[model samples]
Target: MPDTAASKRFTVPIGPQHPALKEPGHFEFTVDGEIVTNAYVRLGYAHRGIEKAAESRNWVQNLYLLERVCGICSHIHGFAYSLAVERLANIEAPPRAQAIRVIVAELERIHSHLLWMGVSAHEAGFDTLFMYSWRDRETIMDVLEGLTGNRVNYSANVLGGVKFDVTPTQADIIRKGLTFLEERTKHYLDVIMHDTMFLQRTRGIGVMTRSQAEVMGALGPTARASNVQRDLRVEAPYAAYKDFPVQMVLDTRGDLEARFEVRINELFESYRLINQILDNLPEGELNVRVPRRIPAGEMIVRLEAPRGEVFYFIKSNGTDKLERLKVRTPTICNMTSVVRLSVGHQLADVPMILAGIDPCFSCNDRTVQIRQADGGAQPNGLSSLMSWEELRQYAIRKYEAR
Candidate 1:
């Protein structure tokens, strides 16, 4: 038996350099023997000041800047930002462009979710699952590269419409790729859900109750894991989401396993959505002309990114340069639950628990700083110091502004 009387609580740092996380984020755990009693996270290691930089850049230049926020979700970021600017400018993209946008967004979701699945599998010590998921992700990357020129950052989206157009042959290639992904993802889902070892490692671990998730403001699969039926795709339809209906997924268990299931299921949902968009793609001009001067106004636009609800607020003073640009990434909203979920879990499982949320450290790193409990101001990593209350107020103000 371990000698409890002689042992004192010790602090262990999980990252900023750990192998488990795909990107860098610092997690510190206070452990009494093997069980974690508390946890703390340090973010902003990757802050690029993209939002503040948007203020100086012209509306068109900001599209490229926003796309670089996270490589995996580049398309969604560009799509959402362009939609916001379009709303302010009172311009509508062609139906074909809208459908194409949806197709690309769904494809991006497949790539990102697959990447996360591989990373999460690695964190849980299942190298085989990691390899299989990552290997299959390449197929989707090839499809994206075929549609656009690049694999990772497609750079396909422009303000009025997409930069690239899919030829009939390219569309056929995409359809074939989607078929392959649908088949491969089925096997992946079976492995994730039915594998005894995976279930043992993830199920009932890092459990969060519905109340806890809501209070912590969890979003995406993290929120869905707790039976929260919130999805920006369904709630606030944008782009082709307005045309294609989105079915929100929810599970009541609120555990690491539930989140795993939700994401795995979403892969199939993405396939379905992509197929739908491709089949019903309309024939029209790909882009509409956007005027140089946007009317003086502010608008808040939200999109359902692979991670969760991504909100972009843009203000224009009838100039090329934006008055203010702000983005609330999904990782920022989900970071609050980290401390809550880490408590009472084994130190060995910390990495898996953290990865289960599919946290995006790079996106989180670009946060605004605020005052700490101490008199001096301190920077919070991966999230703004602004509370959810403050964010709602900011969103309302932007919507209300002329």
Candidate 2:
């Protein structure tokens, strides 16, 4: 007989406070020797009940509240929320305000992608790339601060329209920044595609085919990397995207390398869109008077965030306060995919795999806990994860019923 004890399975918990994850998330990975057999995620540690809290605040106040959902993608949260509210009120923002919204949104995307690049490079032990990327990222941060008087939460988008306008002087500064960013982005594309050391870690790792990505409900660059071609800006064209169109970025490789390429390519497109919007820079009112109380209605708004597609469900009961506000962030949708991809990979690859999806535990834990199948606590349910098949059916039924 063989010594089965030597090959026994064990569990590794990477925590609520680990060196790998900066946020408060606990993960348990079951491993057979060095290979991961299964993985589960728990995220209540950072839960703030933000969805429920949105019910207590009025529509105007909730704009700032939702902006706190994700510091990196703060503008998108407010943008989606405002769009839903505007739809419920049966109104549209002015052309110039809509145009300004798109400019701020694109700038936020550029900063977010650069931030993720630096952090992911740091995880792969490429501190040189990390530092360089972050240093270059500051140029955009300066432009954001100059435009909105704040860097993180620009608060440029109000309920009816944008709160500020881009001056000719400011546009000149932005043009210079975009020129630098375009050149730096090209270098990053070259490095990620050709660098042998970076390729060794990302290539052929965390591979998800286009079908697998679609079935798993992946979104953003993760889906684009697999050639899913599901960008809301391109497909739906919200805000000023109709005026200044976006060119969708797709990669058929369906690997981590493809993800890097997609995002870097997206930066180029964002740079192009920003310059066009600035050049055209419409002239109109900054905002119109929006009613305090919204009409009784409900609407769903989806926008492509830096990480993935962020879905917002807003319901109004003819009041100043929302009757119900449901936010299905991209991290929650992508978390299951991350756990699924972790299986069969080496233990050392877990960090890279998590980073590859750009997991935002802070955004994922905005509301509830991961419930068990038997309606019990998840601590005793190791295999009770919501599978890709289940999520797919749920989405299908959701849209079909709608």
Candidate 3:
């Protein structure tokens, strides 16, 4: 017999050259006419095996290697790994070094969010907004360049502490740039909220409930947009977050509009936190001496990367090199939510929904088959064939049985 499920739904393949964000992820959207019935994702187009590579490099060399994991949130990778190593060695970075790390990390956040805003806008065909957002983002990039001497992959971290200190002049420069960024951010927020064209593409699209977010392991603004309250910065407070606490920004709408609002609002919160750190800058050494070879231990470190929580598990055998280094980036955790949410929405709206997650395909370049059944669709293949409730229950049962 002809496969009824295959006949009822046709698959739409979205890229190794993706339509959304120009990323290297392959998404198969099974649609019945215009409405999407199911979605599946296949990654690994850009995986460089950074985790396995970290095992071969020494403690100092690993910092540089892991920093290349994501060009946008490079510093956070280094920051998280260094924290794990320091924890294993039972060493702490000085107050000054910790403060500087926070500064760069926050700056990286602003840079990443701005870039996301632009790309998401472009995906929705708001090219003018895209251009303006990217133009403003350059300000953060310039500040990062001045501070770290490289815009991307800033190797500002070392084993025990930071590689550099924030000088008074550099502090003034960062403050001035941030002040300008703050003003521009307000304008962008207002535009996104009020622009009818942009609103049409974003609002009410990709709706995810708080329960769904938790069940699917959504994190960062993706979860916060649904009012999930799962920020590592606010909840866990690693690095300097404890000293300069984050003011969580949330929305209960659980739609694309909420995601856009949460991220834009976070830019302001990040600005506030960065200023707080600068004003009460700590005094101490740039770096403490960490032993060339770390003591034997295993530790997990989590940090709020631009997308969400970046998890690093480090294992050492009392050697200069690590035994194993495992990295679970935010993109992988959030990909489940993206594929799940894409169902029952219009196929035209797929790009906006995909962009809403601010997906970093490169960071999540691992193969995953989220559903063992034929896609997320029922055999009959109308979107209503299987309700989200049924789908959720099926997922729960499948995983629990495992």
Candidate 4:
């Protein structure tokens, strides 16, 4: 890394703690007269040792822990984890259970898209769009709570199946809620496409070519906006997606506007999928019994999350506890695109570019690997973890020096 004090380039730091940031992350933008020349991000503030923590807990308990990975997309995390565990145990969830899981997952997609819409609008300084989008988002949240008895972190998944079933009355309520949300979603989409002021903030700015997005390893609607055909739901169907297939939303123009369109159109896709599942809703037992101990095996499960593909790898040791578990979230992939895309753009556009990825640093910060500011790895990455005494002493030394 060049010495910034000696160099002509000015550095701007956006924090590990900042009001503008929704999550904990440190980003540095090297700017030249208000135009960003280069950028980079450092994550780890939210690391909770979830992978290591899962090893000590039983299979059932791990489900609860993993679901808390992201409150916005909790169902997908549990859905992926449960599918992996069930596959390892050689037990398949009933058809009805698979359909119910899909219903919840689609509802989550709706919830996530709306929440993202509002956040991005706020970043663009369009508070009216932000306010109206969030107000309409409550319908989806209400529907989810109605079906699962909770809004966020709906613990819908179990080892062999789901914890709850969608009854007729609940299905009708969902249909009505989605009906209202669908109409609102169409209006929001029209506003994003036609509103001149919002377009000024979104239209040709933060433009990423399809190849650029692919080379940067972008995921979810971020990649889809660039016309990348990379949705795991269609490429590799999981759960009941095989029965009620999804239409992948795509856009040729890879800009902020395209990102908004892809996600807004995806809301329509989710509504269609949910209605299909509910109409042809399968009938069967929600769960099946499994042994207290899982058979020794290794399994990798992948599902299309609201953001992108959620990958989970689980290893069983023929005991109730897992031998190892690893999760690779989509945000980690899409974050790379943000840093690369920020270059050559106005510094003022940085906030919207960051929001463009729909980043969830909390979900991505499962582990920490220390590295120098120059981006070289430490001698032993994991070896840098300090013990309780060392951590306490280190804090005291820093405080005393300050």
* Model 3 lDDT, residue 131, Cα: 96
Full-model lDDT for every candidate? 0.84, 0.89, 0.88, 0.89
Number of clashes in model 4? 0
Give me the displacement of residue 151 in model 4, in angstroms: 1.3
Candidate 4 lDDT (Cα, 0 to 1) = 0.89
lDDT winner between candidates 3 and 4? 4
Model 2 TM-score is 0.89
What's the C-alpha lDDT at position 324 in model 3? 97
lDDT for 363 in candidate 4 is 86
Off by over 4 Å in 1: 1-7, 367-402
**Compared with the true structure, what per-residue lDDT tens digits does model 2 show for residues 310-340?**
9999999999999999998898877888889
Give candidate 3's whole-model lDDT.
0.88
Structural similarity to truth (TM-score) of each candidate: 0.88, 0.89, 0.89, 0.89
> Per-residue CA lDDT of candidate 4, range 1-402, in tens?
776764887899988884244789999999999999999888988989999989988989999999989889999999999999889888899999999999999999998989999999999999999899989889988888888889899999988999998999999999999899889988998999999999999999888898998899888899999999999989998879999999999999999999999999999999999999999999999999877899999999989888888899999999999999999999999888888989999999999988888888878997333322333345654334455576678679889999
RMSD to native for every prediction? 10.1, 10.9, 13.2, 7.7
Q: What is the lDDT of residue 275 in candidate 1?
A: 79
